[model samples]
Target: MNQIDLGGKIVVITGGAGGIGQAIAQRALASGASVCSWDNAPTAAQATAGIASMQVDITSEAAVTAAYADTIAKFGRIDVLVNSAGITGPTLTVQDYPLDAWLKVMAINLTGTFLCSRAVVGGMVQNGYGRIVNMASVAGKEGNPLQSAYSASKAAVIALTKSMGKELAKVDVRVNCIAPAMIESALLDQMPASKRAENLAKIPMGRAGTVDEIAAMALWLASEECSFTTGATFDASGGRATY
Candidate 1:
């Protein structure tokens, strides 16, 4: 819990109502930043002081655009964007996976990231300062069984981070992503019990990571201290990721 100063910064965290997203929002607030959490299903708890919550579907172009406008109206500008909204589609073999489910997963995980990232680029570039930390997964690095859609979508997120990072390389904006193994969060509950156990067993630490650990990494990436690194995937896989 080393201190990272984010004074006077305004952060927008998608999926801010969820476990990991919420943690990041709270951390940012504690770091002296104003936070606006955008989620499709916002919660009462997100009504915390210093945080503005918006019900937004990142998958919709219009919704994303509107959210950006509202955010700008509220905060004047966005300093950080954490694309944490995501889903792990149903657990099933590729042949048994529903087409609709696959599409839905891609829509939320990959397309949503793209839309949100696009929404903030203009403002960030104009301001000459921005930090984008996308939430990817170790599964994206090493494909997991019964998680085809989730894996594929996150892989695309990693690629998108790289592309955006390079596009803004000459600017002060820095784009990066986190590839966490099996973080203990509500999303992990979506996996079958056996599958969860299998994934945890692969980690040398022999335990799932916590929301705080991921939040710490995110907070640093969002800070000025993270300079000199862009288009990179920071691993928080508990020793699960080899490369």
Candidate 2:
């Protein structure tokens, strides 16, 4: 990985126990940032020497607030926040999608992001610097069939990033998101065989992306080099994104 300095920055990544979140934590440590993972299953995070872990349920207001407080107490401050905690609800047609499932997805994917970002923005503003990298999806850009809840929640995340980015434009807090196509991870394993096949067929690269590739893009967005770019959606769709 090409070096992008994040020395001395404190980064908190939701869902840091696994998948893309875990990959980003590794990268952040390598880049010299103090790392913390706020995951519901904190123990799942790799037992690394430099990384801190907090058990947080991002969907609960109280849980998120307490977790943020714990993070600040442990690291002194938060410089970057990665809202990567989300779940893909059961694949079904709109009419057949369970209301409970829809609500759960919205609660975790969208509401959780809002709570975590809200918790950190004040500190960032006070300190005059911040970076937020939200993990959205290509499903939000081009709606994936049978994944209404997932698509809608991610779409909201993209919009939220835009709004927050503009609101803090005068300050140093930059907010952005990544729209990745089908990635080779447990999230993909959640899909049925046919659904996975259909999604991968859309990528011109003829394959799903790796966690490392997504982490690399996220690392850049969380760095000082990302200055001048905010409220933007970076596409990591492997040639699937046209706009």
Candidate 3:
């Protein structure tokens, strides 16, 4: 189609303070989109104070609904929503994994996505146009050891993207996801070096992905330029993922 002009558009990005999230926000801002950046804490001032900043708990439907209300009240429309807030549960096998931590990760990475999508769907249906880019991880596809919760949660995200995409296929909202391999972020420090090195070795590209790479994919998915692809997993695995 045409160039992806996010100019004058309104986009809501959860987890906008951290690496990938911050990168996505910067790209969107550069394209001229008014971004509503949400994290568990306060941020967005440095990136661009003009952008909206809100403290959000992704698992809280009430909080999400209120956030959407604020966005609509202020901007009058929601053009895009990016669910990037997530966490990796404790490093342990399924047998030793704590139920509480597992539940928490699932609630945020999976359920939180459900809540935010539900909150935004109405406005999107009303506007007859919307784009959603959910973040899944290569961990979900390859099932890394010591990361059961994170992998499961992201797998659910992939499934949810497909189901939601089909549900809204005729309604003008497009839903898609990116399954990225290990990236250079604070998240990497949580893993043991051996496991991390093993992962890096698998990538034919021989390195971790950068936040800008993921952000660039998000920009296209959020753009009108990305048509005919929905409910699909776009890979940014640095050649690590094989089928």
Candidate 4:
């Protein structure tokens, strides 16, 4: 492994239950990092073998706050944070979109990042070093048809990553994001076949990206090698997003 020596580092990954979360956790562990898993559906028993698991609903401010505080209490300090929790909003137009679903997606995809980051800011500040990576989507860039709310919320996440990256760059803390194209995961399992195919057609690579691919980029971005590149977004569009 071309590791950055994360053995002694304590890393926290939200949505560490399935899909990319599990993949990222495994990569970090393989590189020798102590992981604290956060998710409502934490698969710590199954997905993670040695990682610490704490079940917490990210949308709830109190829950996320307590989760981070508890993590710090146990790990002593937080070196890396990856916000991977998200949801695919309703497939409806802006006018017909369900209010509840829109808000729910935004809560998990955007507000949850804010809540967790807020909870960890003090610990990172005291430690004088931190790495934060938020997960955005290519949909956020192109604005998927019939998925207005999801696209908008993700777009906000990208903006927030840039904004926070700049604000925290003055200190040792750095923030960034990954905007991935359609990846093969349960996130799209609920969509109609036609809708799913539509997304696949847009990817010039002619196939969906694997969870490990995204995880690899995430692992690197969370490492010390990524020091010079803060306030930036890395593309994982598989040749689809050439612009």
Candidate 5:
């Protein structure tokens, strides 16, 4: 693995317990960055010496605030943030989608991202250095037929990243997001087989992306090398992202 220099960086990854999030944590640790994983539950993977875990419900402002405080107390400062917490709501036409389900998905996928970002930006601004990598999806770029809630949430993430990036343009903080196509992870298990097949068919690569692949791009964005680009969308869609 190519290592990007992150010797003293402290990274906070939301949804860090998940497959992709864990992958990011591992890579960041490998590159010499101290990592803290924030998730609603503990991750199955054991935390190494340079790694820590915190239980946080991203959707709750109070919880997120407390998590940030804990993180700062432990690490002294936060240099990078990876907002990878999200859920793919059930596949259903908009007309038939349940309102409760929609709200739940929105709360977790979109609002959670906003809250976490909001909590960290101030610290980053104070420190005058930060890197934020939000996880968006190809579904946001090309709206999926039966996944209205998930698609819309991601689309908002893209827009949010752009706005935040611009707001922090004058500062050293850079905000960006990734639009990955169907990735082969536990997330795919949430979808029906038919839905999974449909998503795969849309990928020109004729296959799903891997957690490490997405993590690589995320690590690059979180590194000092990503100097000029902020509020930009990095595509990991495998020929699927048209724009």
Candidate 6:
């Protein structure tokens, strides 16, 4: 574990209770940054000494506002924001996809990321330094079969990241996203075994990525060393991403 210096930085990670999110939080703390996790459920047990946990419904504007306010009050400033909150909607063909289910996925995966990013970007712009890392998926780049909602939502996220990154190009506030292939996490449990195998087959590495691997890339993007890149998609898909 090569330590990246994050001293004096304050990071806010959404969906911070999940495996990948928690891994990112752990890395941030290890790098000397204060972390505040925002999630829909309780994740206090995951917090260490320098980390704080807050329950937030990212889909709700009011809840997101209050949560960011609480985070600001506690940390005084948000140096980095990681929009990691998302859900894998049920596996269904677009023709048979449930309208309610599609809406739910969009509400959480896409709109939720937008809400969280909007909440912190103002302060970051004012301060002239910020890093926003949005969690996108390889499925976003290459549309997965029977997962139209999840794929479309993440594709929108990729677009959003590019647009925002370019918008902030001169502001010292970099925005980027990672397009990771299937990762080994609780989220995978949502998929049927056949679906999981089908997804895995696309990865040339023949293995799912670890949370630590994703966290490492995320940490780099959140660091000053990632100075030259913005509005770019970093691939952690193990050759699954074709473009």
Q: Which candidate is the best by TM-score?
A: 1
lDDT per residue (tens digit) for residues 1-243 in model 1: 698999999999999999899999999999999999999999987895557999999999999999999999988999999999999999999999999999999999999999999999999999999999999999898889899999999999999999999999999999999999989899988989999989999999999999999999999999998899999998999999979
Candidate lDDT scores, in order, read 0.95, 0.92, 0.87, 0.86, 0.94, 0.93
TM-score of 6: 0.98
Off by over 4 Å in 1: none
Clashes of 2: 0
Model 3 whole-model lDDT (C-alpha atoms): 0.87
Q: What does the lDDT come to for candidate 5?
A: 0.94
State how far residue 13 of model 3 sits from its true place (Å).
0.4
- How much lDDT does candidate 2 score? 0.92
Q: Per-residue lDDT tens digits of candidate 4, residues 34-111?
A: 988899987637343888889999999889878878987898889999999888876777888878988998999999
Better of 2 and 4 by TM-score: 2
What's the TM-score of every candidate structure? Answer: 0.99, 0.98, 0.94, 0.96, 0.98, 0.98
Specify the poorest-scoring 10-residue window by lDDT in model 1: 43-52
Inter-residue clash pairs, candidate 6: none
Which wins on TM-score, candidate 4 or candidate 5? 5
lDDT of 3 by residue, 5-111 (tens): 79888999988887888888878988889988877875746345566788888799889988888888988998999999888778888999989999999999999
Query: How well is each residue in 2-84 modelled by candidate 2, as lDDT tens digits?
Result: 99899999999998886889889999999999999888877643655568888889999999899888887888999999998
Model 5 C-alpha RMSD vs. true structure (Å) is 1.0
- Residues 137-156 of candidate 6 have per-residue lDDT tens digits of 99898899999999999999
Q: In every candidate, how many clashes are there?
A: 0, 0, 0, 0, 0, 0
In candidate 5 the C-alpha lDDT for residue 125 amounts to 99
